[model samples]
Target: MTELREAAPSAGTDLLDERTRELADYCAAMTGRLRVIGQRLDRDPDAITEFLHEPQVRFPVQGMLPPQYRSAGEFPAPLVAASSTVLGQVVATEQVAYGDPNVILASPGPSLSGGVVQALADEQQRQRYFGRLAAAPTHTFFALTEPAKGSAALELETTLTPAPGGGWLLNGAKCYIGNGARAQLGVVFCRRAPGPWGIEAVLLDTSAPGFSGELLPTVGLRGARISRLRFQDVAVAPEDLLGADRSPSRRGLYGATYILYRFRPGIAAMALGCAQAACDYLRTHRATLPRQDRHRLDGVLDRIAAVRHRTYAVAAAVDAGVVDVAGIGAVKARAARVAEDATRLVAELLGPASLIEHPWLEKTYRDVRAFELMEGTTNLHTMAAFQSLLRSRTALQPAAQRAVDGAARH
Candidate 1:
C-alpha cells in the first residue's frame, strides 16, 4: 500500500513532465507563428488567416490536453502560457491577435484548434488535432451565454435541429462572444430540443453561409475584439456534432465537465497575469511619480504578490490533482477576487495615470475585470463550491458508518 501510494506521485510527475514537453513544443511553434504574424500585423484578416495556413504554423487538433485531466485536474498551462505569450507579442507589435477569442473562453467541446471532431478515446487523433490547433492562431469562441439566457444553460434558446442528411441546422444569436467576430470556428452549445436535458455541443464554421459577426462596443477591454454572432439556419456537417448525438452518456457529461473544470485554473492564471501586469506597471512608474505615493504603491505591490502567490498555489494544486472541481472553482473565485482587489489597489495608487491609454494598467484593470466574469462568475462559483462541500459532507456519513461497523466487528 505504501509503495502504491509512493508510485502514484511518480506516475503523476511523469505525466506532468510529458505535458510540459508538449507545452514547450507548442510554445516554440507559437513563437514561429507570431514571427510570421508580426510581418502581417497591418494586413487584413483574410491575409492573416491565409498566413496561418502555412505548414509551419498549422498544428494538429488533438493532444492539446490529457483526456482525463482535460476537464478535471489539467491546468492547461500550455494553452494559458501560449495565450499570454501571444497576447504579449501582439501588444508589443501594436496589433491585436483576435484571430480566435474562444481559445481563452472556457467552454468544453473541441480543443483550441477549431477541430470539428470530438475526443472519443482516440489518443492519436486527439494528439494530432491538439498539435495543429496549438501551432496556429485559430480564433475560437464559447457561444453559450446569450443575451436572453444569460448564464443559465437550461434557458439557452439556440436550437440545433437534425437535417434530413445527418447534418444539423443551427439558428441562434450569440452576444458578447469573445473571438466571435474573427473566429474561423467555434464550439456552440445549443438546445437541440428544449427540455430538461437538451443542451448539446456543436461546432460551427463561422465563415459558413448564414453566419455573421458584428463588433460590440464596450467601455472596458476595448481591444479584446469582442463581437456578437448571428447564426441563421447555418448548415453544419455531420462531423460537427460534437457529443450531441449521444443519449447523454455519463462519459460524455464527464468529458464536458472536465473541460469546464480545467478552465478554472486557466481563468485564475489570466487573473494572476493581469494583476502582475498592473503591479509591474505601478512599480515601473513609482520612481517617476511623487514621493507621497511611493508608500501606497509599495503596499499595492505587496498585496499583488500575496494574491499572485495564492493564485499560483491554487493552480499548482489543480495541476497536481490535489484539488477537485469544487476546490478549483473556489480557487478560481478567490483568484478573481484577489485580482480585482489588486487591480483596484494599483489603480488607486496610480491615480490619473492608471486610467490613461499610454499605461498598461488600464488594460490590466479592464482585463482583470473580465476574469471575474469568465469561467464562472465569482458568485456562481462560490455557490457551487458551497453546494459541493455540502454534498461531500453528506457523502462522509457512509464512511463514518463503515468505520463504526468495522469497530463493532472487531
Candidate 2:
C-alpha cells in the first residue's frame, strides 16, 4: 500500500508531464470543494441535493477544465477521481437526508472515454451565445441497451427519423436508462433514418413534447433514478446531433466503441472505491468480533486489497494506452465479479451490521451488484472478447493463405 502511494506521482507524471501537474492542482481545488460539500451534506443532506440541482453547482467542470483533455487517457483519471469525490458526497448526503438506502450507479457527465465531455465543450460556445442552457443535476442517459436486442450493441432498435425541415423525429423507447426521470437533457443512442444497426447519438431536451419517462423499480442502485424513456415523434433540431453529421453507421459504432473503452477505467475506479470501503468497514469492526471472525475479516481484507490493486492496474493500463479494447471486456468482467466478492466480504464481516441502513456498506453492496449487469454484463463481455479474438485470427488467415499459394506456385 505504501509503495503504491509512493509510485502514484511518478506514474501520473509518466502519463502526461505538464498536464499531470495541472490535474494535481485541479484535484486539490476539487478536494476543497468536495470537503465543503461533504460538510454541508453532513449537516443538512437536503442542502446538498438542492445544491446539486442548482445550475451553477450542477455543471462542476464549467470553465475549470478544458474539453480537449477527454481524448487523452491521462486526463480522465484526475477528473474522474474528483468526480468520484462528488459522487461520494452525493451518497453521503442521500443517506443522511432521506434515511433511505440507495446507491448512485450512473453519473451525469461524460463517459470515461471523454466523448460526452468533448461534445459538451464543443457546444459550450453556442450554448453560451444562445443562452440556451443545459444544466444538471442535469441527467444524461446512455440509451444503449434494449429489450429486443441482445447485449450486442450493433443490434440497437431505437430509430431517429429525420424531419422535412432538417430536424429529427425520434421514435423509440430506451430501457435501463439511468437518470431518465430527472435529467433535463438526454444523450440517446438511436438508429437514424433506417434500422437498429445505424445507431447514432443525439442530445434531446426531456421537456420537449413527445418525451416521456417511466421509473424502473430496480433491486439495487435504487437512488440512481433508473427509468425507461419514450421518444414518440420527438422533434429535435439538427444541432442536437452530438457528433459530426456523417452517416450513422460510420459515426455510431465509433462513438459507442469510444465510450466502451473510456468507461472501463472509471468502472474499475468505482469498484476499487467500493472494495476499499468494504475493507475499511471490516477493519474497523474486526476488533470487537471473535478471533474466528477476526481471521475471516483479515482474509476478506486481503482479497479486497488484491481486487483493488487489480482494478487500479487496469486503469493504469488504459492510461498508458496499453489496454486492448477487445480485451477490456475481460478486465471489466473480472472487476465486476471482484466487486461482488468484496461486497460479500463486507457483508460477512458486518453480519447483522451489514443489513443496517446508516452505514454505507449495505448500500455499496447493492450498488456493486449493479455493476455486474451494467455496461456490458459479465457474460456479454466474455463473448465479445472471444469474438474479437476470433476476428483477429480470421484476419491473419489471409497472410497464411497467400504464403501457401506462393509456395505452391514455386
Candidate 3:
C-alpha cells in the first residue's frame, strides 16, 4: 500500500484513468480473436484441453503482454495498472464466455504467472523471462497450490533438497496449476527445510528432466489446461532460485503474497464481467417480466454496479499503495458473491427457458460459479477477511466495519 500511494491517485473520483482506458482499448481490439476461440470451443467443449498446443492461438493471448505490462514509470502504479488491464482482459473473456465459457481460461494463465515473475524475480531474471514475452508469445505457470494443502499455500509439502552435486533436487507435486501442463517455465514454491522460514521459491524450466503433467478434468473453464505437475528429482541450477538471495526466509512468502494481492483484484474483475454480462442480457430480454420480477432486476443491476465500482476502488487502492492482503480478499470475496448472485438472478429471470434456450446464459452461470472457487474459495477468503478486520484497530472506522460485515456470511 505504501508503494501504491506514491504511484497512483487517492481513491476518489476519476477512477477511469489513462491506464484503464488503454486496457479497454486493448481488450476491444482483441475481441475478435477471442470470439474465434469461443467459436472453436462451442464446437468442442474440451477444446481448451488441446488449444494451448497451437502457436497461432496461444501467441495472440501471450502477445498481449506487451501492452498490458508496459511500464507506468512508478513503483506500484505500473503493477496496479497492469493488474487493472488484466481485469479488463478477464472482462473481455467473460464477455466472450457469454458465447463459450471455455475461452476465458486461456488469458488468465499468463497474467497470473507473470505476476509471480514480476514479484519474485531479480532484474536480470525479469528481463530474461519477460523479454521473451515482449518479443514473442511465451507461457508460464505459477506453481504453489497442492492437492493435499489446497488454498493453504504455506502448508506446501513440496521439498527442495540440496543436490548431490551442487544445485537442487525438487521432488513433489502441484495441483490445479493454471498453466501447469503446457507452460515453458514455472515458479515452484517449495519448503527449503522443515519450518516457516524454510519456505522458498524457484523458477524451473518445465521442460527439464523429470518434470511432467496431465490435464485434469474440470466442470468449467474447460479451455484452460489446468493440471497437476509432478517434479521427480527435477534438477535446477542455483541461478534458478527466485528473489536472488531472498529465498529460504519469510521473504519468499511475502513476495508470493504480494503477487496474490495484486492479482486477486483482477479475478474480482473477471467475476464482474460475468455479472455485467448477465445484467445486460437480463435487462434486454426480461423486459416483459412481472412487476415484482422487474423490481428484483433493478436490485440486481444496482448490486452489480456497486460490486463493479468497489472492484475499481480496490484497483485504485492498489495503485495508491493502500490496499492490504485482507482488503484484496474482501474485494474478491464480495465480487465473487456478487457475480454468482447476478448470474443466478439472470437464470431465474428466464423462468424455465433457462434450461432450453440461451446457451450463453447457461455457460456463464456455470463459469461464474468457478470464480468463487478459484484463487481461493469464498468461505476461506470470507473468514480470512473477517478475521483481519477483527484485528485491525481501524475496524471502528465506517469503511472497515462495512468490509467486516460484507465478508461474513456473504
Candidate 4:
C-alpha cells in the first residue's frame, strides 16, 4: 500500500513514476528471458501455450487484467502501486514490451476486447466476460476488421439477425484479427440493421456452430496467430449483445470508438518498446562499425527519448480523462513510424549481412513493421490528426485569393 501513497518527486519518473519505477525496472530485468521465449515462439507460435504460466509470461498478462480477477502474487508490488491508472498501465506495458511484444500478446487476458467491456458492458456482462478469464489463463480476442472494410470498421458488413424463436444469429467474416484462431472467447462487431446506429458488438464463442477461423501466414508478429474468420449464422443470445441494457446511442460504435481511444497509447507503447530494443541492439553491435556509423545510432537514441517522454505525457493525459483524439492518433502513428525508422536505420548502419548475423535485431525489424499495421496504419492516423486539427480550428487554411489584374484564370 505504501507504493500507492502518491507520486514521488525523484525516484523513477523523474522519468517513470516515483513508486512505479520498481515495476518498470523489474520488467526490464525480465526481458532477457522473455526475449528468448519470444524468438522461439516466433519460430513456432504454438510454443506459447506451454509457457503461458511462467512468471515472465504470466506476470505482464495478469497485470493487464483487473486485480480482482487475477491471483495475488502474479503482479510485482510496483505494478500493484501503478495498476490504478492508465499511465501505470502505460509504464508496465512499455517495459514488458521491451522484452518481447509477443510474450504479452500470446499470453491472453481480455486485451482489446477487455477495453470494450470496460467501456460498455453491463454489470452482468462484465462479470460473465471477466469471470471466464478469472477461471483460468485464457485467450480472448477482438474481432472487428474485415476483408473489405479494412480500417473503416464502423461500416460493417456482418449482420446480427433476431432468431426465429429467440436469441440471435451472427453472420459475417473478420480478417487480420489477432489471436483469432486460438482464442476460446471473443467479441464480434456486426450490424443489426441499416445506418450508423445499427451496428453492435456481441460476446462470442469460437466453438459456436457455423463459426470458423484459420491462421494467416503473416510475415511478422507471427506469435499473435493473426487469422481469418468466417461466421455462418453463428448463434448469439440477446444477452450476448454488449451494452444491450444501455440506450442505442451508447452501444456498438460508441464502444468500439471508445476502445480505440483507450487502447491506442498502450499500442503505441509497444512500438516505443520495440524501437528501444532496436536502438539498444544497434548500440551493442555497432562496436565493430566505423566511428561515423556509431554516431548515427546515437541520434536515433535521442529520437527515442523524445518519443518516450511524449508517450508518457499522452498516457497521463488519458488517466486525467482527456481523450484528445487527434493527439492519441498521432502518438500511435508517430511511435510506429519511429519504430520502423529505428529498425530500418539500424539495418542500414549495421550492414545488410548484420540482419543475418543478428537474429534478434532482424526479428525486431519484422515485429516493428507489424506494429505499424496494428490498430491502424500511419496514413489513417495522419488524416485523423489533420481532421482533428481542422475540427478544432487549429489547422492552417489556405489564404483567400483575390482576383487581380495580374492574376490569370485557369
Instruction: Output the number of the lDDT-best candidate.
Output: 4
Candidates 1 and 4, the one with greater TM-score:
4
lDDT of each: 0.52, 0.54, 0.66, 0.79
Candidate 4 pairs with clashing backbones: 13-16, 13-17
- Predict model 1's lDDT versus the native: 0.52
What is candidate 2's lDDT per residue for 46-128, written digit by digit as tens?
34454554332433333213433322353355543433332222222222211112212332443222344343324653353
Worst 10 residues of 3 by lDDT: 1-10
Task: Give one digit per residue, the lDDT tens place, for model 1 in 12-126.
Answer: 1222344433443443334334433423432222344454344333322223333442323233545434333212211211111111221223222243323223433234444
| Residue clash pairs of candidate 3 | 1-321, 1-322, 4-320, 4-321, 5-320, 5-321, 48-223
Candidate 2 lDDT score at position 234: 90
lDDT (C-alpha) at residue 238 in model 4: 82
Which regions of candidate 4 fall more than 4 Å away from where they truly are? 1-12, 288-291, 394-410
RMSD of each: 10.1, 7.4, 8.7, 6.1
Tell me which residue pairs clash in candidate 2.
113-262
Off by over 4 Å in 1: 1-137, 164-166, 194-197, 244-247, 250-255, 287-323, 352-354, 397-410
Look at candidate 4 and tell me the lDDT of residue 18: 58
TM-score of 1: 0.65
Please give each candidate's TM-score.
0.65, 0.69, 0.79, 0.90
Q: How many residue pairs clash in each candidate?
A: 23, 1, 7, 2
Q: By lDDT, is 1 or 4 better?
A: 4
All candidates in order of lDDT, best leading? 4, 3, 2, 1
